[model samples]
Target: MMRRWARAAVVAVALIAVSCGGSETTETTASITDPPQINRWVTVGGIEVPIGTTDGPRGGEWEPFAGFSHTPQGAALAAITQSVQLSTASDRNWPTILAGVAAPGEGRDLYAAHRGLVEISGTDPEMVPTIVGYTIADYSDTAATVDVVQRFSDDSLASSTTEVVWTDSDWRLHLPSDDTATITALDAVPSELVNLEETRK
Candidate 1:
């Protein structure tokens, strides 16, 4: 079930996200701060993802998906929010979500073409995965790499790494040139993961 959703939903548009290798350099300009506590969770496509009322997304023109703070926590939050939005986007909302959250790039253009096709002919995906937690892989003022941990109904876990850049005044999703930078099945959720669901409870 999770596999089917991945192929139809996430994989179809998930290609826009940047790769794991290049562009994740950690900056030494300042110390990394702890992410704000999960004060709430907003359900998207039946999945509940974290939200920190005090720290950020701070809100924007895109409402839930835009205007994150410039802090590492803000970047992390933006990554998680956009990852879920991209994974769950359907024909009705993909374009708006893409425009609102993604940085302008060739990768995003290619993804829009592919996603438009899916919207035209593909069936709406079922079994969208739920985000259980996340980890910040790297961070800097200009760019960040966030690994989002998702949990299937069958209890399997995987990490979906996304890159967000500080574009204009807010964090925007940075799509890479390739589609191979998405999810990786995990033996277990990492110990370092800031378990959102667990913490909120």
Candidate 2:
């Protein structure tokens, strides 16, 4: 299920990138806005899924997968949404990853995971989980490079530099297998979080 969600996120980003014609310059210069209020809830088949919140040095944002499934698409969208929300909350600049991306509900199983991560990890600071960090390590017409820092509950920190290419219309993170392994080791993400009833539009 996680794989499926990840694939869906990849597809969504790819589709957006393609539709956008890949012409926009990759810039992290945009100023960040206030963190979005957690007033909105994702409804799937009419059921409500609870999303978690995160508390960091720069206030807090919703963690992805808080009340949603852990599918590939869900994780991907969660990451994106969390990044946007955190940037806004921190009053920092916005990242280009969300420029033309659509809202979360557009996808069913693909709920945001960052919110959940925030909520869960925030509740327990000992378990420090890293989401997306925006630092301009490299950039080009077709790609942007970033350095991400992932922290654990044991006071240990791991860093990885990844390059995201503009594919289809969205920027996608390119993680090597080793980096993937390192991330997976940090936390045991749930496989899926499905809604029992249909959500109302």
Candidate 3:
């Protein structure tokens, strides 16, 4: 449980850096207002926002995870788009959280066991982040992956590669084990978003 939360938090940092990190954000044709609705997510520059299943409409929290794009890539992008939103949402609004996106049967079981294991404070989130652009990083007949550039409000930038698998219901994100550990283990340096003022100085 602890490890999953750690992985989820690190994944959040990575995605946020990607969504909001770049020095200059690419103009996006995609846009949306907050509270994110139930199941709807946005995609821009081949990067789709990812949000997984909610507590369901029971609390009026979210709609069922349905209405995905029929195309495999499209469906994967859609789920990822929502995942980004969930990471940025007020932790308190989601007091109980599930760590990853997974298949219905296996996913539901995991969620049931781990639900409420994580708590988000529901604090007002920082500047809204955005998915600027992405490219298909890897692909198989049944699976697909995306490498994305994400942006934060201050124009800080980061990049991440996400994966997805097709399930009977639709596509779901394939979260890495210990996402933060995984990144650090790669022995990579963090990229700082350049400041124009600093450059000028």
Q: Which of the predicted structures, 1 or 2, would earn the higher TM-score when compared with the native? A: 1
Could you tell me the lDDT of residue 168 within candidate 3? 48
lDDT of each: 0.65, 0.29, 0.38
lDDT for model 1, please.
0.65
- For candidate 3, report its TM-score: 0.48
Please give, for residues 64-125, the per-residue lDDT of candidate 1 as tens digits.
Answer: 37656667777777787776666566678678878777888887887777677764333233
Taking all chains together, each candidate's TM-score versus the true structure is 0.77, 0.29, 0.48
Global Cα lDDT for candidate 3: 0.38
Best by TM-score: 1
| Clashing residue pairs, backbone N/CA/C < 3 A, model 1 | 16-175
Single out the weakest 10-residue window by summed lDDT for candidate 2: 55-64
Model 2's alpha-carbon lDDT is 0.29
* Reference-based lDDT, residue 47, model 3: 30
Ten contiguous residues with the weakest lDDT in model 3: 18-27
Model 1 weakest lDDT span, ten residues long: 18-27
